[model samples]
Target: MRESLKVQPHHLERDAYLYIRQSSMRQVVENVESTKRQYALRGRATALGWRDEQIIVVDNDQGESGASAAWREGFQRLVSDVGMGRAGIVMGLEVSRLARNNADWQRLLEICALADTLILDEDGVYDPTSFNDRLLLGLKGTMSEAELHVIKARLRGGILNKVRRGEYRCTLPTGLIYDQSGNVRLDPDTQVSETIAHFFDTFSRVGSACQTVKAFRKDGLLFPSRLRNSQTTVFRPLTASTANAS
Candidate 1:
């Protein structure tokens, strides 16, 4: 089998770290091909002369965002291992999979450069120690970050445009909901509507959320709570926080 010249004997002697991540749980569930492609990098690592047992997969951050490394345990561990000379090369589907934040990406590159560790992606292997490779990697990181920013900006613009046209569909409060025509209206349920009206009236009289909750408890009244991902509403004992939120 042909091997990359960058994969030296010393590099093959060390473990290969395969870092896998997806931006969100929804993407993790729906973007199966991307995840598979990332896992398939193990084959690439083996082809490069690293043994299967020596390829370490750091996937704890699978459903976590790449925006920052502070909250990603897998990324933190990968960086720590690379810094400690435990990793010969770091493998990812791409630079964006590793990190979207330039600071985070740069930190990892610096650590890898210092440790003489190589980085591999679908494009090719990159040696952070080499000036050309490092420059290219830095550009990739910047573009990844810019891509995220552009996506957010586009989404924000679309939402703003919808709002300007009074067409933005947002979740309503407990006492209101979208009708069949997508217009916001008071809940049709008499009990729910009356209860919410009473809550507001009580709050106005009591002048405190805790007192309103106390009054509801005293009257043995239940507050309507909409269950997540379901159209059904449930009535339960009210708390000060819920009353205040309403």
Candidate 2:
């Protein structure tokens, strides 16, 4: 495979990096196939003559956005290694995994070109220094960036439409919930409703959130709160911030 792709002896001397990333935590959890495919690039590297020791998988950026590379430590490390002439080939599932920002993608391209590093994806192998390969990679980067914009715009438009129709549902903090028809309504629990109503009424009378919390604590009452991981209600001391938010 290395011979077919023109992988030279010098290119095999340094490390081969398998860079992996996902746009968000939800994708990291739901898109198992994509993540597995990216890791499988390790086998491709080995088949290209790089030994197991020479392969490095940078996966710290999982569950991170590729729209920018500023906060991606894994990408930073990959670029640093390439710039320092420690990487022979940088591989990813695709260009989007490297970066969805053109600036970051171009910067990586420049570094790889200068360091004589190869870039590999499922499509094929590419030498950044080569004009044809560089041009194709540049186009991929631009398309990736544009794709991100298109997705954002589409999602934003849908959300705005939903909001206009009063259907833009969000998680209710407490004392409220969506009915079967998706309309917002107060919680069905009588005790929960009374507690929340009393909290608001007390706060209104005291004219201070801090005072309301103090009154609740003085009365030895446990403030009701919704558990994060479950719908079950729990009782705890009222926090000033929670009081204010309510």
Candidate 3:
């Protein structure tokens, strides 16, 4: 509840948009509390004198990254409504939920300012038309963008360091596994190991991936592949393209 947010009669005549978003699908699935908190903003709008119909929840962007607005249909809709003078207030958990990219955030700031729309977050309500509020929001957007960069840099650096130490654990290719002690080796399954060895031997003799694939097809052989994020191994038809890539 900000002093500047007086809820004028004209504001009551317009719609209130509740924007809900999470940076990734993993977060959307794991961060239940954050999703609940974002959805709770609809109650905030209602408390601010908006009827149920007057409040719009833009949650289609949920589980999508706020890093860019290009693919965000919900965010695009919100912006279109605000630009068309339909939005009285735009509420979210925070500015970062609305946008992590400064370009998108600044564009939103400009639209809200021009349309005289109010913005509400966990901190408080703000009028983007107000110089102080707009400045503060711009700073927050910059900080969010910088935060994304810092996080990516840290992750990349960590992965690189692990790689240099021969300790990086990426998704294992077919017929390979890491032991309890983190040493890379052929899969423990003898049949799988033998099949892989046969494939390589055949490929060496053929001197062409296309010929290897033909040989496998002629022999009715299947390639072993591990399913993602699982311990299950499956067999699949190996094509010429797949053989070349492997």
Candidate 4:
């Protein structure tokens, strides 16, 4: 008869990071306790013979709205730090903390996979080198993409509802005005808008954005995206004339 042996858990050492984020104030209050509990991931690292310096933690407080990628400042830095090879692993309270949007979420996951970064959750560790983990990551990214679609749908519905109510759903076009009832109306005095429209029409007929730009320069017109002097003229493209040439 063949003898069976119990397998010992794998023992290895690697740097790790703990990234935490909250979607709203509710998670802030309710999750802080759980958030502190996130330190237990450090214990996991410790068991692997990794020390404290090899680990990092990043968390966002009172973070809600989950829509803006710019909201998580520390999280973004942590990602950068990890990318620089300062650390070799990343952990989060869960997948949602990593990203609320598919783009950012998938980006972090891809970095981890490519960098051979291990991901840990309360259930267990995820080794990116594993074939099954890569496949599971793909599935999770797809699910996150679906989540992104739902969020965009809700935002579109809300904006459309506001528009249907005859309410201003967003700011006036640049150079327009908000009247007393908060309706946006064109400012008759700002000839800039008509100038811009004419420029676009002329450009379409001219067939080159660059040639149209030259025409604007000849006529002392300016692009809104371009910088302007106190007097403001596109003919003197400030960036071009002032900045060192590439």
TM-score to true structure, per model: 0.79, 0.74, 0.74, 0.51
Which run of 10 residues does model 4 get worst, by summed lDDT? 1-10
Candidates 1 and 2 compared: the better one by TM-score is 1
- Model 1 scores a C-alpha lDDT of 0.92
Judged by lDDT relative to the true structure, which candidate is superior, 2 or 4?
Answer: 2
Per-residue CA lDDT of model 3 for 46-89, tens digit only, reads: 88888999988889997888889999999999999999999999
Per residue, candidate 1 scores C-alpha lDDT tens digits across 116-180 of 99999999999898999999999999999998889889999999999999899876677788898
- Candidate with the larger TM-score of 1 and 3: 1
- Comparing 2 with 3 on lDDT, the higher-scoring candidate is 2
User: Candidate 4 at residue 203, lDDT?
Assistant: 65
Model 1, position 20, has a per-residue lDDT of 94
lDDT of 1 at 115: 96
Between candidates 1 and 3, which one is better according to lDDT?
Answer: 1
**lDDT (Cα, 0-100) at 227 in candidate 4:** 27
**CA error at residue 136 for candidate 4, angstroms:** 0.6
Best-matching candidate per lDDT: 1
Model 1 regions more than 4 Å off? 1-3, 181-183, 186-246
* TM-score quality measure for candidate 2: 0.74
Q: For each candidate, what is the lDDT?
A: 0.92, 0.91, 0.89, 0.60
